[model samples]
Target: CATGSAAVRQGIRAIDANAARIVLVVGAEQMTTTSGPEIGKNLLKASYLPEEGDTPAGFAGVFGQIAQAYFQRYGDQSDALAMIAAKNHRNGVDNPYAQMRKDFGYEFCRHESEKNPFVAGPLKRTDCSLVSDGAAALVLADTATALKMRRAVAFRANEHVQDFLPMSKRDILAFEGCEQAWNQALNKAGVTLDDLSFVETHDCFTIAELIEYEAMGLAKPGEGAKLALDGETAKDGRLPVNPSGGLKAKGHPIGATGVSMHVLSAMQLVGEAGGIQVPGAKLGGIFNMGGAAVANYVSILDRIR
Candidate 1:
């Protein structure tokens, strides 16, 4: 999952250096073999040592804490988070490859119930991504090689930016690394956010998506919630995000999530996405993050074949 974007970068480098005409990038994760608690414990290892593991809620707890902090700083946006979850779930219904395809409406996602109880802090069950078992792969080639192929998508810009590892070392809500990656990638591509017709972003948690709105300049900090509430990130909105339902609905199979995002975004650019297709999609953006935004990768892609 974390290496997915980096793997693509390596592939691009390999082709650019003339070391290889093509490169195969793949990622897989088999997470369902373990119980939910066990998975939570494993995910907790991603956080800072000692304290994170001791937290009763595991990964969700960490993100839940982030959500709480954001709310405290900028009003409660649980409604916005629910809207994000509902939007992704609704989009997921059109994705046959998605793990959870059911469209759990906004009401079910927003309010807590016996089935949709809070996992940690304000983060409800629907706010978290699924523990999925899956694999995704892609083939990358040089421009010359791709031009000869029947179908091909080119990477307009691929940039990566890393932040401090410890959550306490930096402002968790700012996601500065994420913001930098987006700005650098777009600048390198000679385009702006509006040039992208759609995007496939890392939504390991619904809160991540909300904050990413601000990180990617879609909204000002502390106001990302308004983007969801106003439906700016909806499928038919100005810049449709996660048209494939995102990790929220498509399932976040650690290793596969990044690869799946690129695949879905490329599909949209090429008109190969049957159900979740965004008409007239010429440019696509992909953001994949690892470890609480510590490692961020952004890719701008467009179909050339």
Candidate 2:
């Protein structure tokens, strides 16, 4: 489930320990081949089955509940969520690998129509990530070996944090695990959020991206909506985010998402990202989570060669 980032972590550890000079990390998922009902059932297995097994919309239902709680405390964020979807969709248009590259405007995403009906809680279909099948791979090597390569993106920091699985055991909307992972990674990298040129975060759903804005210290809690509304996360804004469309449009091939995020960030760092490249990107941040923030991973990357 969390194997995407976990694989990267283990690969780095192996190299760090001098056990391996280079490690190949691969993540692939073939989710679209299955029937819809079976897909839902399989995804449900990622949840705390004892309590969330019967959730109506599978993982979407769980995130929907989180969205509902957030709205209750922060007022309705439908507009902000819609803006995020629209923004990501627009970004996806430039992503050659995106699953859905068509831009659906904010109005279409904000208002629920037959095409974007409510799937769970107040989350419309537009607010959810697509079921995608994709594969992404990375080759990690020691610093000396990496420097000799034509282009290299060095990991300044990488951190992983795990939290309780059951929603009852923790505050579902807080995303404490995500916050912790980001904090630890930044601290280890000896940098602050402002040092990042861009970020590629997990947007399993639009709400997840909204909350992640806060979890990553971009904004205060309950006020993450302002970042999107103010255009701070736009590709040309203060700090560009998800220039790759994130999971919202780039696709959430569950097993491959985390590695995909890292690959995209690395692309930006090395100036290899074509259409989705953030201008003058020197440092990049990446956050990838699994199971409603249960498994949190953060990485900071900078081009060394």
Candidate 3:
């Protein structure tokens, strides 16, 4: 992320920067074997693990618990959160590279399945995303540089936004800054949601997807779940999301995730995506979330030609 950001800063440096026209970003992770569970357990600890030896089974669970409390205190939506899990799992099936290619139906998810075990409260194993090894790369070029190329996609927009990582003293679910990032990104690109062909947001869990709907303004706060339940975020939706199956199905490799999101977005935008391609996508959006909803980066890309 810093690399891409630095490249942008350098590109705009002073006025006379290098003639570089392209920037490539890639994300890779390898978490095979039974170790996947243990590794995932550790990642969930980043949010709010009990430092005093409480050793909760999940960090996000702590957040989930907190979000639950927040909702109890400030209204919450359970249906919306479930949509997050269902959307990504369904999306993953089309992604041959995804770790968990098996898509569990909502009924199966609710009742539990052979592989879908319960993890944390309100967070079943199926509701969570995967930890797998994979890589995604992006080919970016400036508008002027891209126009000269026989094959290239336009760098329509790229904006970075930061959010409160430490959920300790803040409104956990009301991540307005995340919503702001989308506004800034779309504003810079001079387009609206109607202009976007598709979106690839972080779906670390069902709850994440639900919250993203609210954050991205796809739905009113807590209305994100409806998108999933109604299949509005599905492949055939007006605005298809996570055609690559997303992290839930595509696999999340931590540091590589952000880069991978951009890479996939570029692929879909350029019609390089095979089975996952939307009918007519001229523009795309990618939302990569990290470190307990603390860091969110959004990028917008369009076909250069």
Best by TM-score: 2
What lDDT does model 2 reach?
0.92
Flag the better candidate by lDDT, 1 or 3: 1
Which of the two, 1 or 2, has more TM-score?
2
What digit string (tens of lDDT, one per residue) describes model 3 on residues 1-305?
22333233344332235555565545555566547457757575455444412435455465456446645654654554555566667777776667777667666666555776656665667666666666655555555766787766655666666765556656667666568778899999999888888998877766667777778888886556577778877888878888888877877766567766766677787787777788788899877765555666677888766
Each candidate: how many clashes? Answer: 2, 0, 9
Clashes of 1: 2
Model 2, 50: alpha-carbon shift in Å?
Answer: 1.1
Model 1 regions lying over 4 Å from their true place: none
| Tens-place lDDT digits, model 2, residues 205-291 | 899999999999999999999999998998988988899988999899988998898898898888889999998899999999989
Residue 107 Cα positional deviation in candidate 3, in Å, after optimal superposition: 1.4
The TM-scores, one per candidate, come to 0.98, 0.98, 0.84
**Which stretches in model 2 have alpha-carbon errors above 4 Å?**
none
Task: Judge candidate 3 at residue 193 and give its lDDT.
Answer: 82
In candidate 1, how many Å is residue 262 off? 0.7
- Among the numbered candidates, top lDDT falls to 2
Question: What's every prediction's RMSD, in angstroms?
Answer: 1.0, 0.8, 3.5
lDDT of each: 0.91, 0.92, 0.67
Q: lDDT (0-100) at residue 34 of candidate 2?
A: 99
